[model samples]
Target: MSMNTLKRTAQIFLLACCCLTMLVVARSGHKPAPTVDDAAKVTVSNVKFEPRTLTVKAGTTVTWENKEGSHTVTSDTGAFESETLSAGQSFSHKFDKAGRYPYYCTFHGSKGGHDMAGVIVVTK
Candidate 1:
């Protein structure tokens, strides 16, 4: 083959390889790290909190809505508490500090986090 023909073929091959590399990278299922939003919500159904564990940024407010039955969002450390919430009632709390805040339903769980409990992890 002529020198120019060989050079052209090599260039095309390199371009094809670069395109393939980009395609593979796009299909690798790489996801960006999750960003903390200004607020978060959890659902309180019968005998359970929708998300048993949550992570939020310090100063974010979390709201829990009682969707199914009566419950309470009582903190383990007495940092916060809510009245018994019947279906359609809700409670909100602002986590001002970065620490682990565990809570539970008064009727179904205890301070030690028993059957019906959840935890919030606050980050700076």
Candidate 2:
């Protein structure tokens, strides 16, 4: 074949491969998690809250997912509390007001969040 013809064929093959890859990726329905301005996440593992402290805007919903053992998310001032959660369990709370919300695990922390504790600060 002529050199120009060979080059054209190679270009066509590459274009076809690119189109096929795009088609496969699109068909898989893989998409990134949508970003929410008023949502946050905290991971609970190793007997402690991962963030230890979190700051978010008022009206934001915060979710805590337990990854390791059984625990509780109790508020220091009796504002909110959760039942004992085992591995893979989760809890969520919406901070509607702007203030500090201190929490702890009833099984490992005290009312004042002495041990397994965390704090959530909400702002306007």
Candidate 3:
């Protein structure tokens, strides 16, 4: 084939590939999670989390605010975690999957009756 013809063919092929990739991505129907400003708040107070069980949408960001004591939000499956938060401190995480994410305060414990734990229910 002529050089010009080969170059034109390559350009067309590249454009087609780009269009196909965009079509596949659009068909997959994936959306990014919302910003942290739209997050829900959880209150942490003295070895306890108020509203321990929270339900949110798949793209929601959940913010944990320490109202009265120090604590950490550690996920059971290690999906996400936060450093120790003292009074008035806060941490946020975006939930992108639909499942029950159980978390706890590492300093407190995860077993027995005294464990400080919480659950995040993410829905589609």
Q: What is the C-alpha lDDT of each candidate?
A: 0.93, 0.92, 0.87
Q: Rank the candidates by TM-score, best first.
A: 1, 2, 3
Candidate no. 1 TM-score: 0.71
Better of 2 and 3 by TM-score: 2
For 4-36, candidate 2 gives per-residue lDDT tens digits of 999999999999999999999898878889885
RMSD of 3: 12.1
Which digits, one per residue and each the tens of the lDDT, describe model 3 over residues 15-87?
Answer: 9999999999998878888764557989998788778899998999999999977789898888999999988
TM-score for all predictions? Answer: 0.71, 0.70, 0.65
Q: What is the lDDT of residue 24 in candidate 2?
A: 95
CA-RMSD of model 1: 3.7
**Distance (Å) between predicted and true CA of 114, model 1?**
0.5
lDDT of prediction 1: 0.93
The candidate, 1 or 3, that scores higher on TM-score is 1
What's model 3's overall lDDT? 0.87
Worst ten in a row by lDDT for model 2:
29-38
Which candidate leads the pack in lDDT? Answer: 1
- Runs in model 2 lying further than 4 Å from the true structure: 1-36
